[model samples]
Target: MNYAPENSESAAAAVSAIRQMIETGKLPADGRLPTERELAAELGCGRRTVRRVLDTLEAEGLIWRKQGKGTFAGQPPDPTGALAAEIAPDADPLVVMEARVCIEPALAELCALRATGEDVQRLRKLAQRASHPMDADTAELWDGALHRAIARIAGNRVMLTAFALLDEVRMGADWQEQRHRARTPETMALYETQHRKIVDAIERRDGAAAFDAMRAHLEALSDNLRTSIRTLDE
Candidate 1:
């Protein structure tokens, strides 16, 4: 606030104040900023000047805004969200699962072959989190994290992008509804076992075993989803 003179109405002064806030961690990275009105009041500037400052920060990759999500400090989120939303309507859960089954096993195999010591340790932590999630939301979150870790360890950029697209499409509400229906206590237990086996195989550097374990896990998921869809039709 002291970056600007008291009662100053200058855009330059407002920008300096906001930038200093970010630099000093008064505005934490990825944290939402004060509203334009609040910032304007604090800086003794008009909202127009505050708006200009925000626009300048965003253009410099220092902050970003979503339509209704408010301006946030730090670089903009990846462009994949926009792309995912665009293609989600056309995606079917079953087809997406099929794509995952095709891609993930190969990634798992590659991960077993190429993963560094650090990657294996991180994968173990992610697998542990997935194994004992507190609820459905956290289960999904950690499971996704576990799989994405394997994909990253696989070190195939093209395949990882493909995996990411399928992963994003599966987050659609319809897909979530179907997956939730398929998920039960028994299925969750089975998934945990399968996850451990996949991670174990990777830790052992057994490429074939990792490939087989991941494929089996995906097959189980596919079968469960198929059953869920059929039961709904019935």
Candidate 2:
């Protein structure tokens, strides 16, 4: 069916159509989707738009891609075993952020206690990349990766799973839009400073300091998001 979505509405409508198909079982579990070219043709949109929709769906765990195989419908591997199964797919972004505030500080503390020398170095590199991100999207991408790397350093499977699920929700289009709207060069610089502090605390093996730094960073991020939301509303 040629959808022919309007120019302004195309991206969102394309995503919605694919999601509805998946939800209604028109696209069965493990079912492979058409190629990007085919989807663009079928939806009457550009290949770039379809690709973005696919990227978003894949990030949200609604689909998975195999190398040279194709994109298929379903959840990816559960790193936390069955524990990750408890995470709701449609979790609210605010709630996800609140959960991150509760969880990430402790993870940062644990990372301080457990991080190997190499792990610390890896974090330093990630932080440096995030600090000088080429764009808002790149900044968010590296920002998420930096946090996930800290979680990995913490070396706890259950917590890792929780972090992964939260990261997935954070990658949703809505959260991405909110973050993009909230970000400014000034705010990014502030975040870079905060990120540096967190890494510094972790590298020094100061668990308490790491915890506090992470908490402060998240709290500042929450405030920034709120201000942005208000600005967008106005």
Candidate 3:
């Protein structure tokens, strides 16, 4: 329970030691580290410095602090999954997905850098699970949910927020109607399969494969969007 801060007045080593604790077996995966007070006492450093390092870890999703509970470890989240409940009236559906293609590729690379076993497992669950096969109203929610999962894995809040905003645009009534009308059993099956592949590649830690898989999926989406664009409300 000791995180002895360097009394040496070096800011860098304190941060490095924190990283070492996590990287080493001292702080195992999903295991709770000592309290900030304990760490400060142990490290012989100021509480503020310890808190700062912990703050950085939280931002990276390497750790999570519960409001009433203690801090615990966390896996990285996908950065590109869109999770908005509603799309704006004037939002451009294809452009939203297109923007993902631009940002998510790099996010995937970062995911490759930072992703952990737990993160991979979550992505696997999302990718493998069958989407609800139902009417347009129901299907839209499922569709958005899966897309949002992809964003969640990126482990970057800025990226997640951007994707969420775009998802809002995608969730608009006009876009949903176009997507709903275009939803054939064949298309649904195809999307589900492609989504699975993307997750699989990410899980495998194959950066190129993951990127290509994602690209292919977006290509399919782009086609659908183009064909459905004219049908949306003006």
Candidate number achieving the greatest TM-score relative to the actual structure: 1
Q: Candidate 1: where are CA atoms >4 Å away?
A: 1-56, 59-79
Residue 46 in model 1: lDDT:
74
Mind sharing the TM-score for model 2? 0.64
Q: Report lDDT (Cα) of residue 218, candidate 2.
A: 95
Residues 7-47, model 1: lDDT tens digits = 43487888888888887788645588888878978987877
- Which whole-number lDDT from 0 to 100 does residue 66 have in model 1? 82
Give the higher-TM-score candidate: 1 or 3: 1
How many pairs of residues collide in each model? 0, 0, 19
Per residue, candidate 2 scores C-alpha lDDT tens digits across 33-123 of: 8888888888878877887899999999998888898888887655544443455455655677788899999999999999989999999
**Root-mean-square deviation (CA) per prediction:** 9.1, 12.9, 13.6
Specify the poorest-scoring 10-residue window by lDDT in model 2. 80-89
Model 3 TM-score, 2 decimals: 0.54
Compare the candidates by lDDT and give the number of the best one. Answer: 1
In model 2, pairs of residues that clash are: none
Assess every candidate by TM-score. Answer: 0.68, 0.64, 0.54
| Cα-based lDDT at residue 53, candidate 2 | 91
